[model samples]
Structure formats: C-alpha cells, structure tokens
Target: MPGFLKAYVRWVDSANRAIGYAAMLLIFVMVGILIYSSIMKTVDIPPLWTLEMAQFALMAYFLLGGPYAMQMGAHVRMDLLYSTWSDRRKAQVDCFTIVFLLIYLGFLLYGGLSSTMYALEYDERSFSAWRPYMAPIKIIMTFGVFLMLLQTLSELIKDVAKLRGESLS
Candidate 1:
C-alpha cells in the first residue's frame, strides 16, 4: 500500500467520522428537546417552537449527514447488480453512478435555491403555531446537496484511481 493513499483515506475517514458525531449529537438534542416540550405541555407550559424546530432539525439531520453515511458505506444499494461485476467494471459503474448523483444534486441545488429565493422574497413563514423561517430550512437543501456532490466526487476519484491499480487505502 502506498503511504500517500493510506494517509488520504485516513484523513477523509477521520474528518467524516468527527462530522458524524456532531450530527448525531444534534439529532439527539432535537429529540430530547421535543420530548421535554411534550412533557411540559401536560402542565400547560409547552415549548411553542419545539415542534417546528424539531421538524427542521430532522431535515437538517438527514441531509447534513447524508454524505457522511455514504462515506461510511451506510447507504442502501442494490448490490445484486454490482456484485456480479469485475473490479474494473464495478469501478466504472461507480464512476457512472457518481456522475448521476452529481447531476441529480445539481438539479436539487437549483431547485432548492429557487425555492429558497421565492420564500425569502415573500417573507415566507411556516403556517403553524410557531411560524418559523421557512427559507432557512429550504436553504438547508442547498447545503445538503453540495455535501453529497462533494462526497460523490471524492468516491469517484478514489474508485478511478483504484481501477488504475492505485491503492486509496
């Protein structure tokens, strides 16, 4: 194994693992706060914005941590097709898959940006008891899409290098 490839993989894995921890903490906090609010509501002292924030936080958790999941091989995949391929074919498939994901993410980014802009221009707010900022949640879509795109590029590069007999780890 080449030293540089090992170092690069280690760096990416370590950075992503740290990010995963932070995301998990956020998810835990959001859940805890919602439960506490629900309990408080029984005493007629509900946290008015807890539900709203929880909804946004849940979305944030999913999108923000999506790439981390992919990096860790935690995403669902139909490996029946992939398992049949030689390593070179598998790498090619991976490259193409990354391309598809990049295109999909590009659309998501555009749509998310448009939606966010529209919401912001209209001063949109959630139509609920909390009336939280809707645009911010929409803006999260952009961030999430970009993260996915970046991670896909990294994986594609790694696979292509592997196909050339270059060790990434």
Candidate 2:
C-alpha cells in the first residue's frame, strides 16, 4: 500500500478506536441516570428529563461506537458461508460489497446533515415534557455519521490493499 493510504487507514482506525472507548462511558452514564430516576420515583420526585436523557446517551453510545465496531469486525454478519471463505476470498467479496455500504452511508450522511441543519435553523426542540433543544444531539449524530463514512472508506481501502496482496496495518 502507498504511504498515504496506509496513513489514512491507521489514522481512522486509531481515531475510531479512541472514540469508541470513550463512548463506552456513556453506558455508565445512562445507567446512573436510570438509577437516579428509580430513586427519584421511589421518593415521588420523578424527573421529566431522566428518561429522555438516558435515551440520548444510548443514541450517542451506539452511533459513536459504530465505526470502532466496523474496524474491529465486531458487527454482525451472516456467516454460514462467509466463515468458510479464505481471507483473500473474503477480501475480494468485501471489496465488492463495500460499495453498497459506501452508498448507504453517503445517503445517511446527506440526510443527517440536512436534518441537523434544519434543527439548527429552526431552533428545534423535542416535543416531550422536557422539550430540550435538538441541535446538540443532531450535531453529535451527524458527526457520528460522518465518522462512520470515513471509516467505511478506510475499510474499502484496506480491502483493496488486501486484494493487491498488501497490508494496510
């Protein structure tokens, strides 16, 4: 592999791995929020924001962890046939199939950005009782999608390198 491609793969993998590790903390945050909610309910002082905040935390966790999952090959796949394939055969198939993934991620990114822009432009707020401003979460979600797109490209590059009998790692 060329130096630039190798660097790109290394950088993206490092970044996603770091982000994913950080995002793991969100689960603890969510759990704490739920525990607080439970305690509040027991005291008859339930908070309106707890449920919504917990949901937001979960969204952040999933989105931010996605690219790392991809890089680590932790995402689920139907492996009845795939498990039996040689690494080179798998890379060949991956190189072809990744185009569909890239296309899907591109469309997802476009929609996410459009929705984020609309949220910012209108100062959108949730319809729930808490009625929190939507832009922050929208921005985060959009950023996550962008990261996933970059990671997908990195995966594609790695697949191509594998096909050429080269290692990007």
Candidate 3:
C-alpha cells in the first residue's frame, strides 16, 4: 500500500476509535442522568429534560459509534454461509454488499445534511416541552454517516486489494 492510503486508513481508524470512546462516555452520562432522574422522582422532583436528553444521547450514541461497529465487523448479516467462504470469495461478497451500503448511506447523508441545514436556517426545535434545537442532532447524523462513508471506502480498498492479491496491511 502507498504511504498515503495507509495514512488515510489509519486516520479513519483513529477517528472511529475516538468517536467510539465518546459514545461510550455518552452512554455512561445517559445512565447517570436516568438514575438521577429516577432518584429525584422518588422525592417528587423529576427533571423535565432527563427523558429528552436521554433520547438525544441515545441517538448520538448509535449514530456516532456506527463506524466503530463496522470496523469491528459487528453489524448483523447472513453469516451462516458467509463463514465458510474463502478470503477471496469473502472479498467478492463484501464488494457487492459495500456497493449497496455506499448507495444507501449516500442518500441518508444527503437527506440528513439537507434537513440539518434547513433546521439551522429556520431555527427548528423539537415539539416537546423542553424544545431543544433539532439541527445539532441532524448535523451529528450527517457527520456520522459521512464517517461511515469514509470507513466504507477504506473497506472497499481492502477488499479490492485482497481480490488483487495485494497486501494492504
């Protein structure tokens, strides 16, 4: 592999690792918020934003950690037959599935970005009583999908390299 491509993949891997850790931290914070809210509720002092904040944290957690999941090969798929395939065959199958993943993620990223921009321009907010701005979550979604796209490109390169009998690692 060229030094540049190696650097790019390493950068992507690092970014995903950082994001994954952030997601883990978010989960802990969310749990704390819920626990505090529960304890406070017993004293009849429930926090109004706890649920809303939890929802936001959960959304960010799932979206931002997606690239890490992909890197770890944790996504669900039909693996019963795939597990028996050879490396080249696996690469071929991955190439086919990656095309579809890229297409779908492209559309998702576009839509999320558009919605986020619109929300920012119009000062959109949730309908809930707390009414937090929606743009931040949408922006995060768009960025998360963009990260996935980058990781997908890295995976594609690896698959193609494997198919061609080139050692990328």
**Candidate whose TM-score is highest:** 2
Provide the TM-score for each candidate, comma-separated.
0.81, 0.98, 0.94
Q: What is the C-alpha lDDT of each candidate?
A: 0.79, 0.94, 0.89
Clashing pairs in model 3, backbone N/Cα/C closer than 3 A: none
- What's the candidate order when arranged by decreasing lDDT? 2, 3, 1
Could you give candidate 2's per-residue lDDT for residues 63-95 as a string of tens digits? 999999999999999999999999999999998
Indicate which candidate wins on lDDT: 2
Q: How well is each residue in 68-157 modelled by candidate 1, as lDDT tens digits?
A: 998988999888887788989988888877887888888988888888899899999988987887888888767777777767766776
TM-score pick, better of 1 and 3: 3
Query: Could you tell me which residue pairs clash in candidate 2?
Result: none
Q: Give every collision pair in model 1.
A: none
After superposing candidate 1 on the true structure, give the runs of residues whose Cα lies further than 4 Å from its correct spot: 1-18, 84-86
